[model samples]
Target: MSSQYRTGSRGSAKAKVIALVGAGALLLTGCTAEAKRGWLPNVERDTTNHTGAIQDLWVHSWIAVIIIGVMTWGLMLWCVVAYRRRKTDTGYPRQLSYNLPLEIFYTAIPLVLVLVFFSFNNTVEKSINAPVDSEVVVDVRAKQWSWDFNYNYEGQKKYFAGEQAHLNTDGSAGVEETLPTLYLPAGKSVTLELNSRDVIHSFWVPAFLQKLDMIPGKTNYIYLTPQVEGTYAGKCAELCGEYHSEMLFNVEVVNDAEFKAQLAKMEDGHIGEEYDRQPNKVNSVVVEHGHEEGGK
Candidate 1:
């Protein structure tokens, strides 16, 4: 009786520790806030997409996760309690080998669960990968440390961002500045064609939850929607060059009127050209020495 009581007490303590550990693990993976200015927003953090289908699928998958977790813990505890070693422990555990039926049952159950999970996952993948007939498109190219966004608002009617343009400036410290801000009208299905100039680079937007690889020769595609109205920071995901951490772009999702106005302003002003010209003008002062030449 004493041995049985002691075993029960030990089992209780073990179960409490296991529960605490599990809870701690879950808490570690729980939500914590960050600066939200990109493809991922501060509000919707779990499995977000432009269409929100991926998010829905994730919710279903987590249900399975919870169910499986409970079953696993239950089974583990059952085995532990049933086969625990007492004070006068025997030489070895019971000689009961694995049962074929039980093994098959376990295999089949998990297989079926996996298939169910995959069905939802596959559905989402296919839906997302489906051909977009009227999807808005953008081309993107990335090089060492700059991002150039070119929107084809002319004859082709295909808008693209990320063209690998070599930035040249008079100064040697930093290269010329390319397109800094990306403008997109909200509620439009924008597609981006991604490429790399020098090395591999990744264009990632936290709010839009979209990322595309900019390969040397190959162009990749990233599809997303601007769900909300804001300015989001685009970060480089791949370790391309020296300024990996400093490599960042901007995505601005605004209304159609706002986008058109911004584009019109850019066209009329030629901001980039003006920016380049201003620097040369500022540094073009020729210093002439007349009497100071011999005096010094």
Candidate 2:
């Protein structure tokens, strides 16, 4: 009777474990598309050229790490169970001072893994950063707490001077009307020439899975093709100043007609000489204040 009870308890425990695991898997499977994509921003893979490649790299890297982790942990658990010290054991099992083959295997395996990751990363980086004869060129000027976008197309330039974003008491950033916007035509190649009028800032769009720094006295560039028509949130990734958190912008990927219409509206408002010819003078007062605060 006791043996039967023990057997029944073991069976019940295993059933409970199996049921729990099944339930968890069901929940995972029922998750939204965003959750399944590891909580990444909702981006259409087919439309967005780089999104699919980046997401694949990210997911594959995690899968590889998980496989290695499980193997390592299983080996450790097996060693503990199979070769653990026992009461009948008289002395230490055979001990080895060196394991040449094992050492070479472990070292080589990690090196190979690193090389594989590096190769994939390099390929993606090159593909994304490769220069293209872009249809649109945007000069993105980041300032103390605002943004300035200059759109250059067909020998004409239009500019929008964005105001500093207002922060809620809870410190959340949102799409406010005053915030500047960048418009790109879907299915067209675009290049963003990143510049800083004052200190350093970073242009980050989470959905794009990339960010680049804007350093004063230097110019950087980002090359991409927007294939999906949507509004994506953008923000400064680097900590610049007191209102760095409010350094936000919006990217609107639209059809070619809409993009051209938007630029046409800004035709009368051309890029100013202060911002275009003299980038440093756009916000000299704020820049000086930032420098003083930094010295303190």
- Highest TM-score: give the candidate number: 2
Query: lDDT tens string, model 2, 1-296?
Result: 69999999999999999999999987886476556655444666754578788877877888888999999999999999999999999977998999999999989999999999999989988988888889899988887777878888878788776767787777675546667788888998889889876688999887787789988778888888888888888999999989887888888999999998998887444442244324434433434213311110
Report clash pairs, candidate 2.
none
Tens-place lDDT per residue, model 1, 26-99, is 66654444633232334454222443665566566777798899999999999999878988986986686679
Least well predicted 10-residue stretch by lDDT in candidate 2 = 287-296
Measured against the true structure, the TM-scores of the candidates, in listed sequence, are 0.65, 0.78
How many steric overlaps does candidate 1 have? Answer: 17
For lDDT, the strongest prediction is 2
Model 1 stretches astray by more than 4 angstroms:
1-32, 35-51, 86-91, 154-179, 267-296
For candidate 2, what is the TM-score? Answer: 0.78
Ten contiguous residues with the weakest lDDT in model 1: 268-277
